[model samples]
Target: MKFTLLLFPLLALALRSQPRSRTGVTEHVTLNLRPGISLETTNAGAQDWIFQIVGKWSGFQDGHWGLELGDAPTAVYWFFNWDSVASHQEFTRSPEYPATIEKVESLASSFSAPHVPLQPFPPREVFASPVVSWVTFNLTGVANSTATTNWQATANDFLGNLTRVSGYRAHSSGWEVEDSRVFSVLVGWESAESLGAYVISRSFAEGFRRLVSGVAWEHRVLRVAGYVPKL
Candidate 1:
């Protein structure tokens, strides 16, 4: 009986190890909550809506955040994996889509809807208080080819160093499909405050500074709004 239990785990691992492919483009949404409104307050109402939507809807994998304090905008981000962008466009035309958009907008002071195309990378799941750091930067005077190299190298450095951090969760780096020179990095942390610690550490500071020295970058550190669906 004991050996059988062990074999079950091995069987499960073998199954997971088999070749598998995931399809879909990820959709990211951000909401800058209205003044005086807090994430805690928005979370309860958002959770209610998520439960309803996920129960009947398809395509949404997860929504996460990279929240910040001070004058920076507060945002909630969602990722959807659909077969094609056309499918997502069709989904927007659905009756439920407008109502869903309205509910989300009602919670924010302003939101972003720019059509920045992104190439999807394998998605990673993150738990805990998931603090995300979003960094978008423009290369300075560097050719596209050179910029691509820098981007890849920086991504490797950041992700490689992240593994040594105590609270690391998941990290994704991607280039803008329309303009490959523009890139974004999203790194997750276990707790809201954990990101701050990592950012101030010598390791992160040295690597980030070396990478962004000649570049103009915008970095936003945010708190993840808890809106996980049980289903």
Candidate 2:
């Protein structure tokens, strides 16, 4: 399950711009589990809280929740599509917010929730896949206009190639508004085995080197099984 070359980071910068009919945003939440806390316990607690929100909150479009895999696996990630940031903020002020947080807080040592606007919002089917690969890239140095443009081209090409791979279900990406230098990608696959196979392939090795060469950056990739709450 560990391949040094296969672990190369993928994609950076936002996708090509396009018009949108409505404003939308995806909230990325990471909950790092407390020591000795099991994923099953955390998942059950979180799922109950999410179910309540989805059922009552009108802004909740769709969601994908899963436990992180590989290095630093003691975390759970949730990607939720909301109507807008304002709607999410409204949810925070709701009466149910504090009780929900209290339920999940016991299992998590720390957590972070950041929102990004994904151009051409991802469909519900993407997160519905068997496995999802969430990757984040943090630009190491100053990201000037020229360097960013070049990186965009390379990143887009790499993302395009990923779609051609077998078992690739869907892909969506965006840059965090709070921190422009931070980029995120969500790619769905039929299975973790397929993703593992693709990562070790010769093509991945070449593409990875091309993407990261001379680009001072740090990245993390987490493979997680798609979680669909029974409503």
Candidate 3:
């Protein structure tokens, strides 16, 4: 009875000492941006608008998201990071996104629904890095097996070179389990500037095209340092 009484107080003290803030945390999300749209159109205007916002406003405090563009991605795949929901709320209410309440309502209609929410499949934990340079190429008219092989090969070459350029590098890709037709790649870089330099550089840009040519990948989305998986 005496030992139990002593242990209870220690356990209570430990629990009280735990940190309460959830800031600098990351969350995974799968947003169905334009699920029902036909290939001809998928709210290109809205997509572009959001892309602009993400590029400019995101990564403000070492918090960002990643995108997984399938052959027909609807802008759902993303990872969100923030010190906490409070910062996010502030950002949403900031003059950048909504100068006035009226303007906010007017532009709000553009979203598919719940613009940024937790992903369907929960991640083990948010990556330690605040940013990840990533690109998603939509595969066109290629077999699943072929797409994977092509992606892996491209990853092998690109990751090695990128790592050499910058000491930090990692690459990941996954084919849609539901339909082998879709595939996506996630590449990491220490800084967004490094990614931009490589993307536009003649030497690296053409290599990207050549790598995806066989699989006929379309460069749909290029996102800056966003999110990475912890486990």
Question: What would the per-residue lDDT of candidate 2 be over residues 1-231, giving only the tens digit for each residue?
Answer: 111211211101111122222468887877777777765553565656655665478777777777776644787777778777666666666787666666666667666666778865844666767677776666656458788778778889999999789989988888875567777777888888888899899998898787676655533345554554423
Q: Candidate 1, which segments miss by more than 4 Å at Cα?
A: 1-23, 65-74, 79-84, 113-122, 127-129, 177-179, 227-231
Residue-level lDDT of model 3, residues 1-231, one tens digit each, is 012222322422332343433434332233333346422244434544454554455433333443442354444334544444344445554566533323212223232111122221122122333335434445555567666676668756765566555424555444432233545444555555675677777768766766667554534233332433221
- Scored against the true structure, residue 51 in model 1 reaches a CA lDDT of 41
In order, candidate lDDTs are 0.55, 0.67, 0.42
Model 1 residue-pair collision total: 5
lDDT of 1 at 139: 69
Model 2: ten consecutive residues of lowest lDDT: 7-16
Q: Against the hidden reference, what TM-scores do the models get?
A: 0.68, 0.78, 0.40
Error of 2 at 203 (Å): 1.6
Q: Rank the candidates by TM-score, best first.
A: 2, 1, 3
RMSD in angstroms between candidate 1 and the native structure over all alpha carbons: 13.4
Model 1 lDDT, full chain set: 0.55
**lDDT for model 2:** 0.67
Q: In candidate 1, what are the lDDT values of residues 1-231, reduced to their tens digit?
A: 012222322422332342332334444445556666555554556645844664355544444443454454455554433443444454455677656655665566555432223343434454234566767776645667766696668767767788899788877666543244657666767875777788789998888877777777877666665544424
